[model samples]
Target: MKRLVRLATLAACLFATGTVALAQPAAAAPKTLRYSFPIAETGFDPVPISDLYSLTVVAGIFEAPLEFAFLARPVRMRPNTAAAMPEVSADFRTFTFRIKPGIYFAADPAFKGKRRELVAADYVYSVKRHYDPRGKAGRLYRLESAKILGLSELRARALKERKPFDYDAPVEGLRTLDRYTFQVKLAEPSPRFLYVFADGSLTGAVAREVVEFYGDRIGEHPVGTGPFKLGAWKRSSSIVLERNPGYREVLYDEEAPAGDERLQAVVREFKGRRLPLVDRVQISIIEEPQPRWLSFLNEEQDVAENVPAEFANVAFPNNELAPNLAKRGILMLRYPRSDVAYSYFAMENPVVGGYEPHKVALRRAIALAVDVEREIRLVRGGQAVPAQSIVGPESWGFDAAYKSEMGDYDPARAKALLDMHGYVDRDGDGWREQPDGSPLLLEYSTQPDQQSRKLTELWKKNMDAIGIRIVFKAAKWPEQLKASRAGKLMMWGVGWSAEQPDGDTFLAVGYGPNKGQSNHARFDMQAFNALYEKQAALPDGPERQAAMDAAKKLMIAYMPYKVHVHRIWTDLAQPWVSGYSRNIFVREFWKYVDIDREALARRGS
Candidate 1:
């Protein structure tokens, strides 16, 4: 697909004169923050595709089943969004939740723009959509809905046979007590039910009116009760959003006892606070990093993300960005990336036969040979920090102590492991060979971007010294992703943004169900799967923690992939935007923000 670079260029021109201003006092005009990124959002549908660009636009206006405030913020799992939380019945098979009243979807002209209250039927409708055979909502199926009473039977008949599901049927165990109340009779208790609600894709409650209104066009015109409303979406160029007045935050008083940190954070951000501050937010698609930085530097854009490495040394130039901006010390919010950028060695269809092996020695040899920290410092220009695990330290269940056993530089140990496994270069050809004499010359695929290429080249230099020949293969983003999923890759560079704050999102891809869908390396671990199942059945806290730790440790032990680096995203905001906070993923940028009136005045000045 051709990127709409001109749309961003035109939008850049649109705000060039800076004529558009938020309605505010002449003394200090509120700032309109213009954020730009290289990737273009494909659509507003939250069903899961790599591009998170459009999700940001949609999330701004729509509330899902769960909410997150990036890193360090507690995750909120709504009762309306979840079937139950905290407690599981003694029978360990049923969970129930009572919904709160007064919550409503965004007002659209179709609904007369008046807030429409949400109901239990809405959630039932949303969950059923995922079970639809025709619905390509892969992320939704990641949750083991079969554990929910009637869901198991429906899943057994409709899903097992791969047939279309009739969502309107009367399921045996699913029932609604009232308009705002619902209960699910689980086949067994799932302590991690709260995690499912917060999975965004799993828990996002959609209005029945929305499903019926657009029918199939709901992806284009989604309606949710989020802080913002979709305004104008000029495909490939820019997507705009306006504040939703119907939205209210759950406020917290100092008197409130210790509860869910995720719940508390949401209440703190929105409760009693008038959001948006700015009338509209414009997201520009600027694929080339150089041009994005140029626009921000020229004051053509209010905020810029993923600032190119070239500008790292110069982002703060003696207050040159906006003059008085230096006096404010440039508010920089740093948080660990929910997504870890890593390199994977695909064993090819031949190495692992028809399936990839979950071997410790083989993966350890690969991990030991690679020097991750050095690669990050040199190739990434010190923009990234080493990542030992796929899940960052900030993620709810991630274990810092589980950083892969393949510690700092050790070429001798790497070679020793291979030699012990009978992988040796007997011919002195500078490449290791199997017992059959086939050379271990693997092709490494990566995006054509400069940084990725450099990282790949670094891998080549390090691995080649250990008698492993790695040839670099370059492909565009879409091509690379397609090939990776198809298992047509021998090795590749890949990254993931946490769909929520847990290991469940990362673990879902590699299991049998997701196989080719997301598990690019095509590795299947039985121990990991068992742990995931156990974690799901147990309630949140220590029991679930122990199970998750086992799974995480197993993942690291196998070394299915090498963690190159975790990152702290940087967004350059033109001194005007006030409540702008960094999100764990770039797509969450819309959630918490308030344009600065003073910044707008300075732009005018």
Candidate 2:
């Protein structure tokens, strides 16, 4: 009887333990968002890297003083780390900013167990890093005309001494009045300077300790105070970014203009919610279009940012979501890109790059021969529009009614111009020769890809029609870019996306000082340079517009760059992805994106 009583006691104890175990809560599963990049990101450092892919990744890991409103239609600037908008002087040369307190950088070894709170001095240091000649920042020319007081002298001194840049050196243009207040003084009136800051160029604050710790490997070691931190990177294959656990609590809020139904719905869904809804992000680099498209269709990726032109018909019929994809609850968002794709004639090259009348006529003839409409229809699957000028449609100085001869397609006019310039088939070879009887064969650099091949064939046909001989040189995109920068390639095709909504952003590429950097053409026109400077000093009004128009006309007349087409991109998102919107001016939309884990699991995505 005693043994039976003990057994009953043990059984009762087991039942109680079981009950307690069932009452406890379960741990939540992690939420992750998967995506892909058509090209591998170059690196994390923002100073030397100018590619859009790298900038997009950098945006997540860095916080700028100012940022674009997340959901604004017209796209307005707002304070991100700043307490308020900058205080600008009447002359628009001096601007002061106050940063918000309590913001801390992500914990790193460089911090050495000390809290790294962001202060005004951090911004000053970050800007100075770009001026370091050793860094060789790609976008340094953007600030060349700004002429920050004492900055040029500092750079000169550093070059003369051949020593490390003195970060502690005081520059009058960049001053920290206090712990939170920072002032920027420009030599000339620069109304668009704030826009440059609002973009990622000058906004990201780099702690001096972090830079010192990383040294030469700073590109690989990116440390910033943003929503996400770098998790893992496999050179050219994949990248992962995890949520910053120490990130400050910030809710999603924006003052969007009313009467937009789509934006209203987005606001209702995410207005008060905490940002960075997704816990993790996975990026796969799939260079080939077929594999990338297959991965997206197989539900491995949540978003496909750019639909390949070859699959445009299959993805979007009549520019709307295909019936099949729509049936699967997939969403398609279309936006006209604020970008331009063009070919640059290396003005430094002996054969093609010259300001002589015949050379100019030859370039004009080649530009007039190529039919942009046919190229768009056949090669791009109706995904682009003929670009009128260097400035795209969304920018301020883009004139819709402005017409030019450079963009026109006239084979007869092309042949006539070539013949008038003494270019003729002298050796009965059916190809034109220079007036001096030298073989006039143009070498064009292009990537070895299906799209590039198609474009090359079209170019060959156009050149043949005009009795001009051309040879195609295949090289990787980066290789081609390097060759163009070194002034080795005669001509090459490239594209530029606007970092800000200003015409100057596009015009700066042709500016003389930007040569060997942004200006691949190496075009140095005295008149165009003067107009560029004049426009930079004026505000976005009639005077500035006139100056910009004159510059555009000059660019077209010289034919240094044959501006081709502006793309219309169709972006796709899986059903499980929400709050996904396309912003041309901003690429860092991961924080605003959310993943429906339950729905993803239900669809087996």
Candidate 3:
């Protein structure tokens, strides 16, 4: 009877232990968002890096004072790290900003085990970095041209004195009003200056201590008070980011288009969750077209940001979601991309570059001969619209109905122009020679990608019909970009997207001062320069648009660059992805994205 009593006691203890174990909660599953970039990022450093892919990563890791609303259809601006929208003077020359208190940068070794707070001084230092002679800023011209009070003078003094920039000196135009407030005094009225504040890469605050500690390696160690922190980086191969534990709480703010059923559904799905629902993000650099698309098909990546044009037909046969993929619960979103793809002729190259009438005729003839429509239909898989203007359709001065010779493809006119300019077959070789009677072989720059190969094939056929022999120069994108900036490339095709919806951004490409920067073609015309400055100071209206129109006509007349087509892009998201609408002006959307933990967990199991 005593042994039975002991056995009963043991059983009671076991039962109590089992009950406690059952009451405990299970570990929460991690939410991860995986995606790919078609091009390799240079680095995260904002001032020198100009590539779109690098800036996209930088946007997520850095915080600007203002940001575009995630779901707003017209791309509305809202306060990000700032306490509120900046106050501007009636003339628009003076602007003041108030930073929010209590924001802290993500913990880093540079802080020496102490928390670093983001303050107005950090912004002051960040702006000074661009003016510093040592930084070699790629976008310095934009700020200098804005006529920021005393800022350009500071940069000029640094160059003249052959010394480092003086960051401590008080500049009349840019000064802090207090601990939390800063003011910018422009020399002239700059109505669109506020747009500069919205881009994180240009205006993102960086702590001086962090910059000093990392020095030249600051690009590798980006310290910011943003939603995500760089957890690991494999240079060009892969990049991974984890949610910032110290990130200030961002509540759900659904500002979608009214009565839009699709967006309303997404708003309801992410209605209650704190932003950055995804705990981690994994990014891979897959430059090839096929593998990038296939990874999405295999479900290895959660989103395909821009589906490859080569496989667009396969993904959406007849531009509709395929039946086989619909069963697996995939979503496809297609939109007209606000960008321009064009080919520029280096104005310094002896063969293709000259201001002479014949030189101009040769370029125009080539532009007219190349069939943009055929290229779009075949190479781009009918995913692009013929670009009528260098200024994108979304810009303030763009006119959709106003057509120009930029988009024309008349082979007969091209042949006639070539004949008038002394570009004719010599010695029955059936290939046109230069006006100087030298060989007229055009060295067109190209990449090794499948799409590039197809485009090159089309160009060969088009040029062959015009009696102009052409050869291709193949190089990696980075190398070609560096060469293009140095005026080493004869001709190269590239795309430029607007950071802000302004016509000036595209018009600035022809401005003489921007040569080797935005103006890769080096087309320096005094008349265009005068118009560019005149329009920049004018308000967005008929007067400013008229100036822009005159500028675009000059660009087309010279034919330094041939604007090809504005692209239409298709992006795919898996069933588990949520809140995936794209804002044209907003590049940072990772924080708004929510990964379904349960669905992702199911797939893993």
Stretches of candidate 2 exceeding 4 Å from the true structure:
1-27, 255-259
Better of 1 and 2 by TM-score: 2
Candidate 1 weakest lDDT stretch, 10 residues: 249-258
lDDT of 3 at 106: 93
lDDT of 3 by residue, 1-605 (tens): 99999999999999999999998999876788899988788788777777788888888888888887777767668888889999999998998989999999999999999999888888777887888878877676667667889988898899999998899989988888888888889988888888888888878888889888999999999888888989999987899989999998888787779987878988887786787888888999998889988898888999998788888778887889888777777888888777899999988889889899999999999999889999888889888899877888677898889899998999999999999989988768899998778899999998878888888999999999999999999887777877887789999998888888788878877889888778889989999999998998888888888999999999999988999998888888998887787877878788888887666667635
| Model 2: lDDT to the true structure | 0.86
lDDT of 1 by residue, 1-605 (tens): 13578888778877864655643337633235577756666566555444455545655655545544343335444432333343446766665556567777877655766668877777667666665655555454454433666664676688677776777787756667788666667766654555555534445667766766776677778777766677777776777776666776533221112564533554465556555456567778776667888887677777777666556556634223434445543454334667777666563456522222323565677787788778756665556777766666556677666555644568898888888877788898777886467766767787666667667778888878788776788876656766776678877777766766666666655454555555666666677778867776665688888887777677677766776677656566655655555646335455455665655656645
For each candidate, the alpha-carbon lDDT, in order, equals: 0.63, 0.86, 0.86
**Runs of candidate 3 exceeding 4 Å displacement:** 1-26, 601-605
Could you give candidate 2's per-residue lDDT for residues 235-337 as a string of tens digits? 7699899998888889988554588666678778888888788899999988777888889999989998878887899999789899999989998988888
Give model 3 RMSD, 1 decimal. 2.1
